[model samples]
Each structure stands twice: as structure tokens, then as C-alpha cells.
Target: RRRGGGGGVETAADFARTAPRAGYLHKLGTNVRQYKRRFFVLRPSTHLYYFLGPNDAEPRGCIELDGGGVSAVRELETMPDGRFRFEISLGGDGGEGDAGGMDASFASANDDGGGGRDGGGPRRIVLEARSAECGREWIDSLRSESLPYVRAELESSRSEADELRARCAALEARVEEMRLVERDRDGAV
Candidate 1:
């Protein structure tokens, strides 16, 4: 398992070509609860990946911002040292613990000194940014990227609501027909 500084150094052009948001952030370890600096890259696909370093060929872990993988992203109160932080709450059925779909060795490495699972069910990952402005920018970028998933969900809900409304209308029409039949029967009697 690679530590913080094993990968190649990233150039400005690399950042420009790869992702809009790519930088170093201190991630709170799940088991140790200690903060470790990791290089994160937020992709256009709504996947936030953290590497041991900027040039790692494969990501140590990935957090899917769309598809119910992420529940929320919110800024946290500043630390006593004045560090701006944010939390990413993973959805219930999201990645495996704090490893975020990492392999066993990678997860174990993180568990020992890096990061790990907090507990059962949905979990949250806290990341500290270099500054308040940077923190807010990261949050905004994450929220914006995840909007597609939210829009898709909204579309689904609207379709369901339309179906329910149609069902209700049909039921009301059936009730009105039954009432008419009852009135005719009473007149005939």
C-alpha cells in the first residue's frame, strides 16, 4: 500500500487536462480518526477519487457522487486551528465502508494509518481543505456534479406522481358512474 508521497508530482497542465477540482485535502481516518493528506480528483463523471499521490495510476478509492452513492455534502465548522472542513455522507448502499470500494490491502493500509470505516450503515467522510474558500469551492463543485442524479430522481418522482393522479381520476369516475346507477335504480323502484 502506498503512503502520501509515493506517486509522481502533478503539473498544472495535468490538473487542467484531468479535472476541474484536483488538490490535496486532509481526510480523517475512520479507525485512527487522524487526518492524512491525500490528493483528490473530482471527475466529470461525478466520481471523486483519492490517490496516494497525484500521479498514482489507479485511485486508492473512489466516491460516486451520483446514483445514490452520495447522500449529502456539507461544510463543517472550522477546526480550532482555523482549517475549513467538509463532510461527504455516503448513501446507505454506497461503497464498502470508508475504503470506498478499495481493495483489501488498500483498505487495510488505510485502516492502520490512512482511513477506514467509521461504523455500520451510512457513513460520512470528513475532509479538511487548505482554506475556507477552497472548502466552499469543493462543496460547490461536488454539488454541481451530482445535480444530474438529483434531476433524474426528480423526473422519476414526477412520473410516479402523474401515474397516481391518473389512478385517482379513474377511481373518481368509477364512483360517479356507480352513483348514477344507484339514482336510476331508485327512480325505477
Candidate 2:
């Protein structure tokens, strides 16, 4: 009998053995680390993760299913004409949940001519942006401008706060010393 109710007991391995219940075309990928709170799925094959918003000048990275869970490790790049190319590998035997079906998952990543069908077929997704600066160029801007600006502001504030704290500590110590002197004088009287 099934441990829960409807069927028999199933181990984690059993769930892993099962195939995807249904095929999902053009599933986007997202990460809380690189893309912040934004969640977007790129083409399935490429699994490209494009960060959207007025501030997002370029797409971030991609996510791949290592096994049961997803991993955001590889990075995706765009071509001269705004097209993207994602190349990753699936380790071990090419089985049910292997990366073979990734082509259909990211179908939007392909061109209209369908000429760039690698070995399997066109990627299942493309994850186009409503508005985006050039790909890598935009990322460089973030590093050169936004991040540096934030860091500098934080450092300056921290230094000021630290100096204030030190001054307060010194004043407190002086007050305690005066209190002891007053106590000694009173005791003598």
C-alpha cells in the first residue's frame, strides 16, 4: 500500500525516476542572487534568465537542472544581432529527464528561419526583453557605475558612524571617572 494514501510508498529515487508529467515549452529561469527579486525564464534549451525592469539593462544568467533541483551556475551570452546562445551539458546517461528535451523547452530562442537548429532542434524559448541595452555592455555598466556608487556611499556612512560611536564611548568613560572622584571626596568628609 502507498504510505500516504492513494498508492504505495515512494522514495526520493522513485520520484527522480519518474518523467516530467508534461512538457513545458519556453519555461523561463530565474535566480534571487544575480537578478535580485526579478524572476524570468529564458529559452528552455538555453534556460536563459533575463532580468527585466527599467534598471535591468541586460539579461542576467541562466539556470540548469542538475538533477532533481535547479542550479543557477552557467551564464548566457547574446550575439551581435541581439540573439542569444546558451551551451551547457547534461552529465551522465541521456535519459528521461536529461537535457535532450531542452530544445523544446526554449523554443523562443530560435530564429524565424529555423536555420540554427543545432543537433536536436531550435531552442524552446527566447525570453526577449521589452526594452534592453546591448547584452554584455549593459552588465558592464552596472559594475562600473551602480555597484561602485552604492559601495562608496555605504563606506562613507560607516566611517562617520564609527567615529561618532568612539566619541560617545570616550565621554562615558570620563563621566564614570568623575563620579568615582566625587565619591572618594564625600567619604573623606
What's the TM-score of each model vs. the native? 0.60, 0.26
Candidate 1 — worst ten consecutive residues by lDDT sum?
107-116
Model 1 spans with C-alpha error above 4 angstroms: 1-16, 96-121, 147-189
For model 2, where is the 10-residue window of minimal lDDT? 19-28
Residue lDDT tens for model 2, 1-189:
123554654332232233221111122332211212233333322222323322332322233332312211233665466543332333332211222243344323311211122476323222222223433332232222333344677899999999999999999999999999999999999
What tens-digit string does per-residue lDDT give for candidate 1 at 1-189? 334364754432254356868888888876677888878887764577776676664556667676667887899878777789888887756542244444555443333232334556466788999888889999988887775755876899999999999999999999999999999999999
lDDT agreement with native, every candidate: 0.70, 0.35
Identify the leading candidate in terms of TM-score: 1
Error of 1 at 131 (Å): 0.8
Estimate the overall C-alpha local distance difference test score of candidate 2: 0.35
